[model samples]
Target: MLDKDATEFDGACHCGAVRFHVRLSEGLHSARRCTCSLCRMRGAVAVTARLGDLHMLAGQEMLTLYQFNTGTAKHYFCSRCGIYTHHQRRSDPSQYGVNTACLEGVSPFDFEDVPVTDGVNHPSDGNGQKGDGIIGVLRFQSVGC
Candidate 1:
Protein backbone atom coordinates (compact mmCIF):
# COMPACT_ATOMS: atom_id res chain seq x y z
CA MET A 1 0.00 0.00 0.00
CA LEU A 2 1.25 3.49 -0.88
CA ASP A 3 1.32 6.28 1.62
CA LYS A 4 -1.83 8.39 1.52
CA ASP A 5 0.15 11.62 1.52
CA ALA A 6 2.61 10.55 -1.14
CA THR A 7 2.64 12.59 -4.29
CA GLU A 8 1.11 10.42 -6.98
CA PHE A 9 2.09 11.48 -10.49
CA ASP A 10 1.48 10.18 -14.01
CA GLY A 11 3.67 10.14 -17.09
CA ALA A 12 3.69 8.90 -20.69
CA CYS A 13 5.57 8.87 -23.96
CA HIS A 14 5.43 11.55 -26.66
CA CYS A 15 2.98 9.46 -28.69
CA GLY A 16 1.00 8.54 -25.60
CA ALA A 17 1.78 4.88 -26.19
CA VAL A 18 3.37 4.45 -22.77
CA ARG A 19 2.19 5.54 -19.35
CA PHE A 20 3.06 4.91 -15.71
CA HIS A 21 2.38 6.03 -12.17
CA VAL A 22 4.99 7.24 -9.70
CA ARG A 23 4.55 7.85 -6.00
CA LEU A 24 7.16 10.04 -4.32
CA SER A 25 7.50 12.69 -1.68
CA GLU A 26 6.80 16.28 -2.78
CA GLY A 27 10.34 17.65 -2.55
CA LEU A 28 11.80 14.31 -3.52
CA HIS A 29 10.55 14.63 -7.10
CA SER A 30 13.22 17.18 -8.03
CA ALA A 31 14.89 16.36 -11.39
CA ARG A 32 18.41 15.16 -12.13
CA ARG A 33 20.48 14.58 -15.27
CA CYS A 34 23.43 12.28 -15.88
CA THR A 35 26.47 12.99 -18.07
CA CYS A 36 27.16 9.39 -19.06
CA SER A 37 27.33 8.87 -22.81
CA LEU A 38 23.92 7.22 -23.11
CA CYS A 39 22.24 9.71 -20.80
CA ARG A 40 23.69 12.64 -22.72
CA MET A 41 22.35 11.29 -25.99
CA ARG A 42 18.90 10.61 -24.58
CA GLY A 43 18.48 14.08 -22.97
CA ALA A 44 16.82 12.48 -19.96
CA VAL A 45 15.88 14.43 -16.85
CA ALA A 46 15.51 12.01 -13.97
CA VAL A 47 13.41 12.00 -10.80
CA THR A 48 14.45 9.46 -8.20
CA ALA A 49 12.02 7.02 -6.68
CA ARG A 50 12.05 3.87 -4.65
CA LEU A 51 11.56 0.71 -6.71
CA GLY A 52 8.21 0.06 -5.14
CA ASP A 53 7.04 3.64 -5.71
CA LEU A 54 6.87 3.10 -9.43
CA HIS A 55 3.91 1.32 -11.02
CA MET A 56 3.55 0.38 -14.64
CA LEU A 57 0.06 1.64 -15.24
CA ALA A 58 -0.09 0.32 -18.80
CA GLY A 59 1.87 -0.85 -21.83
CA GLN A 60 4.10 -3.24 -19.94
CA GLU A 61 4.75 -5.36 -23.01
CA MET A 62 5.81 -2.33 -25.03
CA LEU A 63 8.66 -1.52 -22.68
CA THR A 64 12.23 -2.48 -23.48
CA LEU A 65 15.47 -2.38 -21.48
CA TYR A 66 18.80 -1.01 -22.66
CA GLN A 67 22.05 -1.84 -20.88
CA PHE A 68 25.45 -0.41 -21.57
CA ASN A 69 28.65 1.02 -19.98
CA THR A 70 29.50 -2.11 -17.99
CA GLY A 71 25.84 -2.99 -17.78
CA THR A 72 25.45 -1.11 -14.53
CA ALA A 73 22.17 0.64 -15.24
CA LYS A 74 19.13 -0.79 -17.00
CA HIS A 75 17.46 1.93 -19.07
CA TYR A 76 13.81 1.12 -19.72
CA PHE A 77 11.94 2.56 -22.66
CA CYS A 78 8.79 2.04 -24.67
CA SER A 79 9.79 -0.26 -27.49
CA ARG A 80 6.88 0.84 -29.65
CA CYS A 81 7.29 4.58 -29.05
CA GLY A 82 10.99 4.61 -28.33
CA ILE A 83 10.55 6.77 -25.26
CA TYR A 84 12.93 6.53 -22.29
CA THR A 85 10.52 6.20 -19.40
CA HIS A 86 12.78 5.34 -16.51
CA HIS A 87 15.90 3.44 -15.57
CA GLN A 88 17.62 1.61 -12.75
CA ARG A 89 20.46 4.08 -12.22
CA ARG A 90 23.91 2.55 -12.21
CA SER A 91 24.97 4.62 -9.21
CA ASP A 92 22.18 3.20 -7.10
CA PRO A 93 20.63 -0.07 -8.15
CA SER A 94 17.97 0.17 -5.46
CA GLN A 95 16.50 3.39 -6.91
CA TYR A 96 14.44 4.17 -9.99
CA GLY A 97 14.99 7.38 -11.96
CA VAL A 98 11.84 8.31 -13.81
CA ASN A 99 11.92 10.86 -16.61
CA THR A 100 10.30 14.02 -15.25
CA ALA A 101 9.21 15.08 -18.74
CA CYS A 102 7.19 11.89 -18.99
CA LEU A 103 5.09 12.94 -16.02
CA GLU A 104 1.61 14.30 -16.81
CA GLY A 105 1.02 17.40 -14.71
CA VAL A 106 4.62 18.41 -14.14
CA SER A 107 6.01 20.39 -17.04
CA PRO A 108 9.78 20.63 -17.31
CA PHE A 109 9.17 24.32 -18.08
CA ASP A 110 7.93 24.99 -14.59
CA PHE A 111 11.14 23.99 -12.84
CA GLU A 112 13.50 26.72 -11.71
CA ASP A 113 17.23 26.59 -11.03
CA VAL A 114 17.70 22.85 -11.35
CA PRO A 115 21.02 21.94 -9.69
CA VAL A 116 23.97 20.80 -11.78
CA THR A 117 25.98 17.68 -10.84
CA ASP A 118 29.35 16.42 -11.97
CA GLY A 119 29.23 12.86 -13.32
CA VAL A 120 32.17 12.96 -15.75
CA ASN A 121 34.51 12.46 -12.83
CA HIS A 122 32.15 9.90 -11.41
CA PRO A 123 33.71 7.16 -9.33
CA SER A 124 34.99 4.20 -11.32
CA ASP A 125 33.64 1.68 -8.84
CA GLY A 126 30.32 2.04 -10.73
CA ASN A 127 28.96 3.87 -7.71
CA GLY A 128 29.28 7.25 -9.51
CA GLN A 129 31.17 10.30 -8.09
CA LYS A 130 31.18 10.94 -4.38
CA GLY A 131 30.60 14.71 -3.81
CA ASP A 132 26.87 15.42 -3.89
CA GLY A 133 27.07 12.44 -6.26
CA ILE A 134 24.59 13.80 -8.87
CA ILE A 135 26.06 14.82 -12.22
CA GLY A 136 23.57 17.57 -13.06
CA VAL A 137 19.98 18.63 -13.10
CA LEU A 138 18.94 19.39 -16.68
CA ARG A 139 15.86 21.48 -16.15
CA PHE A 140 13.65 23.02 -18.81
CA GLN A 141 15.39 26.33 -18.23
CA SER A 142 18.73 24.80 -19.13
CA VAL A 143 17.23 23.49 -22.37
CA GLY A 144 15.99 26.99 -23.35
CA CYS A 145 12.49 28.45 -23.38
Candidate 2:
Protein backbone atom coordinates (compact mmCIF):
# COMPACT_ATOMS: atom_id res chain seq x y z
CA MET A 1 0.00 0.00 0.00
CA LEU A 2 2.81 2.40 -0.63
CA ASP A 3 2.47 5.37 -2.95
CA LYS A 4 4.36 5.18 -6.22
CA ASP A 5 5.98 8.55 -5.61
CA ALA A 6 7.69 7.54 -2.38
CA THR A 7 11.23 8.94 -2.08
CA GLU A 8 14.54 7.37 -1.13
CA PHE A 9 16.19 8.59 2.06
CA ASP A 10 19.90 8.48 2.89
CA GLY A 11 21.18 7.45 6.33
CA ALA A 12 24.30 6.58 8.28
CA CYS A 13 25.63 5.79 11.73
CA HIS A 14 26.89 8.30 14.31
CA CYS A 15 30.54 7.48 13.56
CA GLY A 16 29.94 7.20 9.79
CA ALA A 17 30.99 3.57 9.91
CA VAL A 18 27.69 2.46 8.44
CA ARG A 19 25.42 3.88 5.72
CA PHE A 20 22.40 2.90 3.67
CA HIS A 21 19.40 4.04 1.69
CA VAL A 22 15.73 3.34 2.37
CA ARG A 23 12.80 3.95 0.07
CA LEU A 24 9.67 4.86 1.96
CA SER A 25 6.35 6.54 1.48
CA GLU A 26 5.80 9.92 3.11
CA GLY A 27 3.12 8.30 5.27
CA LEU A 28 5.75 5.88 6.66
CA HIS A 29 8.42 8.48 7.39
CA SER A 30 7.32 8.75 11.01
CA ALA A 31 9.26 6.87 13.69
CA ARG A 32 7.74 4.15 15.88
CA ARG A 33 8.96 3.25 19.34
CA CYS A 34 8.16 -0.27 20.50
CA THR A 35 7.77 -1.33 24.11
CA CYS A 36 10.15 -4.31 23.89
CA SER A 37 13.02 -4.97 26.29
CA LEU A 38 15.92 -4.43 23.85
CA CYS A 39 14.23 -1.61 21.98
CA ARG A 40 13.67 0.33 25.21
CA MET A 41 17.29 -0.10 26.25
CA ARG A 42 18.59 1.05 22.87
CA GLY A 43 16.02 3.85 22.41
CA ALA A 44 15.25 2.66 18.88
CA VAL A 45 12.58 4.21 16.70
CA ALA A 46 11.32 1.80 14.07
CA VAL A 47 10.39 2.98 10.57
CA THR A 48 9.15 -0.08 8.83
CA ALA A 49 9.21 -1.16 5.18
CA ARG A 50 8.50 -4.33 3.32
CA LEU A 51 11.69 -6.39 2.87
CA GLY A 52 11.87 -5.59 -0.82
CA ASP A 53 11.74 -1.86 -0.20
CA LEU A 54 14.96 -1.73 1.84
CA HIS A 55 18.55 -1.90 0.54
CA MET A 56 21.86 -1.71 2.30
CA LEU A 57 23.90 0.59 0.05
CA ALA A 58 27.04 0.03 2.12
CA GLY A 59 28.53 -1.38 5.31
CA GLN A 60 27.10 -4.85 4.99
CA GLU A 61 30.31 -6.31 6.39
CA MET A 62 30.14 -4.07 9.46
CA LEU A 63 26.65 -5.25 10.44
CA THR A 64 26.19 -7.80 13.20
CA LEU A 65 23.05 -9.60 14.32
CA TYR A 66 21.95 -9.98 17.93
CA GLN A 67 19.12 -12.18 19.13
CA PHE A 68 17.86 -13.05 22.58
CA ASN A 69 14.78 -14.08 24.51
CA THR A 70 12.75 -16.21 22.08
CA GLY A 71 15.51 -15.66 19.48
CA THR A 72 13.13 -15.08 16.59
CA ALA A 73 13.83 -11.37 16.11
CA LYS A 74 17.28 -10.35 14.87
CA HIS A 75 18.61 -6.92 15.86
CA TYR A 76 21.28 -5.65 13.43
CA PHE A 77 23.97 -3.16 14.34
CA CYS A 78 27.35 -1.85 13.35
CA SER A 79 29.95 -4.08 14.97
CA ARG A 80 32.68 -1.45 14.97
CA CYS A 81 30.56 1.40 16.28
CA GLY A 82 27.76 -0.31 18.20
CA ILE A 83 25.06 1.65 16.38
CA TYR A 84 21.74 -0.14 15.95
CA THR A 85 20.42 0.29 12.43
CA HIS A 86 17.54 -2.11 11.95
CA HIS A 87 15.86 -5.30 13.17
CA GLN A 88 13.53 -8.08 12.17
CA ARG A 89 10.53 -7.90 14.47
CA ARG A 90 9.10 -11.15 15.82
CA SER A 91 5.55 -9.98 15.07
CA ASP A 92 6.23 -9.69 11.35
CA PRO A 93 9.41 -11.20 9.98
CA SER A 94 8.53 -10.15 6.44
CA GLN A 95 9.17 -6.52 7.27
CA TYR A 96 12.41 -4.75 8.15
CA GLY A 97 12.06 -2.10 10.86
CA VAL A 98 14.73 0.51 10.27
CA ASN A 99 15.70 2.92 13.02
CA THR A 100 14.18 6.28 12.15
CA ALA A 101 17.00 8.12 13.95
CA CYS A 102 19.49 6.74 11.44
CA LEU A 103 17.70 8.24 8.48
CA GLU A 104 19.02 11.62 7.45
CA GLY A 105 17.02 14.81 6.85
CA VAL A 106 14.06 13.52 8.86
CA SER A 107 12.62 14.38 12.25
CA PRO A 108 10.86 12.27 14.81
CA PHE A 109 7.10 12.30 14.38
CA ASP A 110 4.67 13.06 17.19
CA PHE A 111 3.21 9.73 18.30
CA GLU A 112 0.10 11.08 19.96
CA ASP A 113 -2.26 8.67 18.19
CA VAL A 114 0.06 5.75 17.48
CA PRO A 115 -0.97 2.59 19.26
CA VAL A 116 1.49 0.86 21.54
CA THR A 117 1.59 -2.93 21.00
CA ASP A 118 2.30 -5.23 23.92
CA GLY A 119 4.99 -7.76 23.00
CA VAL A 120 5.65 -8.70 26.61
CA ASN A 121 2.64 -11.00 26.76
CA HIS A 122 3.03 -12.53 23.33
CA PRO A 123 2.34 -16.25 23.06
CA SER A 124 5.48 -18.34 23.01
CA ASP A 125 6.13 -19.95 19.64
CA GLY A 126 2.48 -19.55 18.62
CA ASN A 127 1.68 -22.35 21.05
CA GLY A 128 -0.83 -22.44 23.91
CA GLN A 129 1.87 -22.45 26.57
CA LYS A 130 1.34 -20.12 29.49
CA GLY A 131 4.88 -18.86 29.12
CA ASP A 132 8.25 -19.90 27.69
CA GLY A 133 9.94 -18.16 30.65
CA ILE A 134 11.85 -15.66 28.47
CA ILE A 135 10.51 -12.27 29.53
CA GLY A 136 11.53 -9.22 27.48
CA VAL A 137 10.00 -5.89 28.54
CA LEU A 138 10.45 -2.51 26.84
CA ARG A 139 9.24 1.11 26.71
CA PHE A 140 10.11 4.01 24.36
CA GLN A 141 10.62 7.78 24.34
CA SER A 142 11.07 10.13 21.35
CA VAL A 143 13.12 13.30 20.90
CA GLY A 144 14.26 15.45 17.99
CA CYS A 145 16.66 13.55 15.74
TM-scores, one per candidate: 0.80, 0.72
Model 1 regions more than 4 Å off: 1-6, 25-29, 124-128, 134-145
Q: Per-candidate RMSD vs. true structure?
A: 4.7, 6.2
Model 1, position 112: C-alpha lDDT score: 64
Q: For model 2, state the Cα shift of residue 30 in Å.
A: 6.0
What is the per-residue lDDT of model 2 for residues 1-145, given as tens digits with 9 covering 90 to 100? 2232446778887777788888764445344666567866886657777678778888888999999997989888999889898887787788788876677764344333333444555554554435432343333355646
- List lDDT for all candidates, in order: 0.72, 0.67
Tens digits of per-residue lDDT for model 1, 46-72: 778888888887888888989976788
The prediction achieving the highest lDDT against the true structure is 1
- Tell me how far the alpha carbon of residue 87 in candidate 1 is from the true structure, in angstroms, after superposition: 0.3
User: In model 2, what is the error at residue 34, expressed in angstroms?
Assistant: 1.5
Best by the TM-score measure:
1
Worst 10 residues of 1 by lDDT: 136-145
